[model samples]
Target: MKEYSIREDDLTGEAIAALLRLHLSEMHQWSPVCSVHAMPIERLRAPDVTFYTAWDGDRLAACGALKQLDARHGELKSMRADPAYRGQGAGRAMLDHLLGVARARGYTRVSLETGRPEPFLPARRLYEANGFRECAPFGDYVADDFSICMTREL
Candidate 1:
């Protein structure tokens, strides 16, 4: 039986530290753009960002965040599923939960920036399956062959 729960919370210093380490050391092993490597976890804990962690029994299975860019806009951030649970639909579950939160909060649009690498194909596919489409860069992102920008209107 697969049981899991998703909830928004302030990823504590310890949890955030561990996540940052995995994102930097493990994920970066395959990703070329490791910009999130330098971001302090406190940034995600900011007033505008709502971060969520998914747990399967006390173990963290996945996590993601929705950052309120403005009144009607939000940006997806730090979407990662534990490598151990990668193929179990945890990522998709986290994504659907985040989108529901954004929609319920009245966001008019949601955008995300993901890598353009072979390892990122699944991530991009997940977004596309949920209706995200390629778009011009927004927020602090710029045009980079390695970074693919995507957006979806609510």
Candidate 2:
């Protein structure tokens, strides 16, 4: 397997935009319109959101983001691995990097909202393996049947 590196990313790049579009498309397919929480590229560009991408040299392998919700809390957003890079640890690497960033920023907790459907099982599993557990909705999110919220204490 090729080695990949994760770094802060500018979402305006063409390759990054394409990856985000794919992530949004997948979210829409598996989640109801009202429950789709995937952030748009424009939203990810907001000042409070720090976006990162994993690259295998010239190839964009995955992406994720951390959105500051408060002094002690952060939310994970827009995590996705390129189809070609799925199961190759790209998503895990991106997630780990974002978690590290959250810790470095002095966040005491990290939370995420993801779909509850079959398509999202892998993501939930990934978070679970990383010590995230089911939690009530945090920040501005509300409890919903289509969404599962998870959190971890940093």
Q: List the residue pairs that clash in candidate 2.
A: none
lDDT string, candidate 1, 41-139, tens digits: 778788988888888888788888898999899999888888887988888998899999989999999999888778889899999999999999898
- lDDT for each residue of candidate 2 in 42-90, tens digit (9 for 90 to 100): 9999999999999998899999999999999999999999999999999
Return the TM-score for candidate 1, rounded to 2 decimals: 0.89
Among all candidates shown, the one with the greatest lDDT: 2
- TM-scores for candidates 1 onward, in order: 0.89, 0.97
Which ranges of candidate 2 are over 4 A from the true structure? none
